[model samples]
Target: MSLPVNIDEYSRLVVLDDNELQAQNVAVSVRERLQRLRGIYAYWLQFPSKFDKEIVDYDMKKFKVGRAQAYDDLHLTQILMGNLQQASKEFMRWKINRDLEEDLRLARQRGDLRAAASIEKNRIMNNRTDKDDEPELEFDKIVPQQFEMTDDPTVIGIQKVPGLRDRIRKLEKKYGDTKIEDADYEEIKEEHDGNGTGS
Candidate 1:
């Protein structure tokens, strides 16, 4: 589906405004346009040449760009996508910070000293100047609301730590006898190590 504005008009989004409200407005618009373009990109990937005119027309009518500008300029499209990705990351970061602040506020209000201390420490460490500006939270536990058993053989095999430990013991015995190939033994050992089954 095409956007209301031509894709070329959205070139302004490449240089977002300094004003928070203006930037948010542009980001919302750009997100919609990007979603539309993503659908077209997916379709083009599947059916290569079929939607060329449709995509071009959508870009021209909505973005106010010429045919050549709309159809051939992949670099511009990629840049817009990059901007969207950055905006999304920033938004998620902001949301996480906001949530943690809210949680800390609640903890303080409830006078939960232990929870407040841990959450405050996490917030401080997360916003520490020496480290990268990333959001981190310390949780006592993660209780999954739902769990499902996978039918996939690979997943089933990976989940079987006991079976893997037994195999590792067999591999170790073979390795001692010099009966197993070094490559095969190393590969199994790597898997065993990943499973945290042995030293």
Candidate 2:
């Protein structure tokens, strides 16, 4: 018997192929094409019905199906298209989450301990209610003048002072040797001798 040109007839034709391998191959090809067509149909359904005839004509040509077959095919195609779209959206969300987790793991393994801790803290904070804790000030807000310019001579002369040997010697003697009474050499020697410690 000849295959029916309609979708219902096409299904019957699938059952009649004598070569099982050929039938399976055709079925796989048709199903794959049908999935792609469904995706297109999902997008097309977003358009107004005034373009129905245009859409139908386009599908018939695109799928190489007869007019009668195209009519029923469009409906089934639309249902599959909707499902595929949802699946695609869900897959994208899952993929994004997986990628973020991988990046976090790599950051931790690379000794970026602060970054790993921040990620974990963010995740924990995100799961809590707004009232759970007070919001902490952001780094930029806490130190608003961090990047601002200063006119202090100490700031301007910082680079120049390092190269001045005389100034460094004077500053070092004045500041570096200014020790507390508790840090006197005699007190240190007495403590060390009493403890019978050798340096």
What is each predicted model's overall lDDT from 0 to 1? 0.56, 0.54
Which digits, one per residue and each the tens of the lDDT, describe model 1 over residues 1-199? 1223454665654444436425566566456445445544554455544444666676677667555545543324544443333455567667777888999999999999999898877776655644775553212132324557864456555544457767878898977575655463343533356667865
Expressed as tens digits, the lDDT of each residue in 1-199 for candidate 2 is 1122346634444334336535556566555445435534654756534243566677677767655445545544544334444455567656765665777899888999888887666544444433466563232222222356764457656554455777877899888885657653553443455667964
Q: Which residues of candidate 1, in runs, are more than 4 Å off? A: 1-82, 124-199
lDDT of 1: 0.56
Q: Supply candidate 1's per-residue lDDT for 151.
A: 45
The residue pairs in collision within model 2 are: none
Candidate 1, 195: how far from true, in Å?
99
In terms of lDDT, which candidate is strongest? 1
